[model samples]
Target: MLTFYSEGSRLRQARTELHDGALVTPFECPERLDLVLKQLRQSGLGEIRTPNAYGLAPVQAVHDKDYVTFLANCWTEWVSAGHKGEAIPNIWPARTLRGDRIPRAISGQLGYYALAAETSISEGTFEAAMASKDVALGAVEHTLKTGEPSFGLCRPPGHHAAYDQFGGYCFFNNAAIAAQRALDSGMGRVAILDVDFHHGNGTQQIFYQRDDVLFISLHGDPEVTFPYYSGYADEHGQGQGEGFNVNYPMPPGTSVATWMAALDQALARIHAAKCECLIVSLGVDIFVDDPISEFTFSSEDFTLLGKRLAHAGLPSVFLMEGGYAVEAIGVNVVNVLQGFKQSME
Candidate 1:
C-alpha cells in the first residue's frame, strides 16, 4: 500500500492541553507519526511520499468558507494582535452565551469558533494542518486512480472538527474531506468506517443530512468517551440521510470479540448500502496502553480488525487519525493493513 505523510506535522505541537481538570501534555503528538513511519518502513509497508498540493475547493466542500478562511489566517491575526504564545480558545458559546456575533477580538473569535483549547493555532499550525489534509487528499487521489488501498499518515488527526467548528486536537476534517472528494468523483455511495478510540462526531455531523455518503463509526461509547456529546447508537441519520449513518459506540473495556462483532454489524449495513468505496479513519489509540483512551484492544486485535474490514471486499483508503502508544502504534496500524493484504490474497 502507498502511504502519504507530511513533514509539516512537526510544526504545531502544543505545550499542554486541559485534561482531567488539569493542564496536561497532549496524547496526540508529532512523535506518534514519526514512530509509525519508522515501523511502516521497517515492516515493508512500501514507500511513502509527500502530498501534492491542491486547490481549496476540496477543503471548502466540507468546511464552511469563513471557517476555512479563519484557519488559513488565524495565526496571522493572532500575531498582529500582539500574542506571543499559541492562540488557544479560552471561551466558548454554550448554554445561554451569545453566539450571534463573531467577535472582533481574537480571543472571543477563538472561543466562538473552537470547542476546546487543546487545539491551538500556533504560527505554523495552519500550514501543518493543511499539509496533513493534503496528505489525505493525495492518498484519496491515489486510491481513485489505482483502485487499490493506500494509507495516509495524517497527524493532528481530524475526526472531531465540524464544518464550522474546531476542537479535539483537530482543525481540518481530513477524513470528511476525503469522503467528499470521493463523492465528487462519481462515487455516489461512499462509506466512512472510523475505528478511532473516540467518536468521529465531526464526520457524522457533516454528512448527517446527506444520503450520497454513508458514515459509520466504531468507537468508545459517548457516555464514557471524549468529545462527550453525540456518538450515541440512536443518532441515526435524519431526513434524506435516514438509516445511512451508523454509530457502534461500545463501552469501556471492550475486547476484540465484541469490537469485531460490532464491525461485522457495520459491514452488513455497508453492504446493504451498496457503498462503492470505503474510507477508514484509522486510529491505533484503541491499543491497550494508549494513555488518553479507554478501549482495551490489543496489538493482535488490530490485525484481526484489518482482516475483518478487508473481508468486506470494498476498495479502501486508510487515514491515520489518533494513536498515542508510540512504541506499538505503527505495528498495530501496519498489522491492520498487512492483515487486509493477506485477506485479499
Candidate 2:
C-alpha cells in the first residue's frame, strides 16, 4: 500500500495540551507520526511517498467556504490579537449561544466553529492541516483512478471535525473531504467505515442527511468516552439517509473479539448499502496500551481488521485519524494493511 504524507504537516505541532487538569506535553505530538513511520519500516511493509498538492479547491468541496477561511486565518488572527500560547477555545456555542451568525472576533469565531476543546492550534496550524487534507485527497485520487488502495498519513486527525465545526485535534475533516471528493468525482455509492477508537461525529454530521454516502463507525460508547456527547446507537441518519448510518458503540475495555464482531456487522451493513468504494478512517489508538482510548486491542489484531475489510471487495482508501500509542502505532497500522494485502491476493 502507498502511504501518503507531507513534511509540511509538522509545522503545526502544539507545544502543550491541557491534559488531566495539568499542562503536559501533547500526546498528539509530531513524534507520534515519526514513531508510526519507524514501525512501518521495521515491519517490512514500509512504502511511503509524499503527495502532489491538490490545493484549496478539493477542500472547499466539502467544507463551508467561510469556515475554510476561518481555519486559514485563525492562527494569524489569534496572534494578531496578542495571544501567543496554543490556540484553544475558551468558549463554544453551547445550547444557548446564538448559532445563526458567524462571529467577528477570533475567539467568538473559534467558539462558533468548534464543538470541543481538544483541538488547539499554533501559528502554523492552518498550513499543516491544509497539507494534511491534501495528503488524504491525493490518496483518494490514486485509489479512484487506479482501483488500488492508498493510506493517508495525516496529523491532527480529522474525524471529529464537521463541515463547519472544527475540534477534536482536527481543523478540517480530511477523510470526509476525501470521501466527498470521491462522491463528486463519480463514485455513485461510497461507504465510509470509521474504525477509529472515537466516533467520527464530524464525518457523520456531513453525510447524515444524504443517501449517496454511507457512514459507519465503531468507537468507545459515548456514555463513557471523550467529547462526552454524540456517537449514540440511536443517531441514525435522518431524511434520505435514515437506513444508511450505522454506529457500534462498545463498552470500555472491549476486546478484539467484541470489536471484530462489531466490525463484521458494520461490513454487512456496508455491503447492504451497495457501496462501490470504501474509505477507512483508520486510527491505531485502539491498541492495548493506548493512553487516550479504552478498547484493549492488541497490535496483531489490526491484521484481522484489514483482512476483514478486504473481504468486502471494494476499492478502498485509508485515512489516518487518532492514535496516541506512539510507540506501537506504526506496527498496528501496518499489521492491518499487510493483512488486507494478503487477503486481497
C-alpha root-mean-square deviation, each candidate = 1.2, 1.3
Instruction: Please give the CA lDDT of all the candidate structures.
Output: 0.87, 0.86
RMSD from true fold, candidate 2 = 1.3
Q: Write model 2 residue lDDT over 105-182, tens digit each, in one string.
A: 898888888787666778778888988998898899999998998888898688988888887788888888888889
The number of residue pairs in model 2 that clash at the backbone is 0
Give candidate 1 misplaced runs (Cα > 4 Å): none
What would the per-residue lDDT of candidate 1 be over residues 1-345, giving only the tens digit for each residue? 899988987887777677777766777778888788888889897889898987688889999998888888888999899988778887888888887889888888899889767676766777878888999999999999989899998877899989988888888899999998888899989999999989998998899999988899999988878888889999999999999889998888898788888889999989999999999999888889998888888888888888898977888999988888888988999999998888888
Clashing pairs counted in every model? 0, 0
Local distance difference test, candidate 2: 0.86
Question: Which residue pairs in candidate 1 have backbone atoms (N, alpha carbon, C) closer than 3 angstroms, thus clashing?
Answer: none
Model 2, residue pairs in steric clash: none
How displaced is residue 118 in candidate 1, in Å?
A: 2.4
Worst 10 residues of 2 by lDDT: 39-48
Worst 10 residues of 1 by lDDT: 115-124
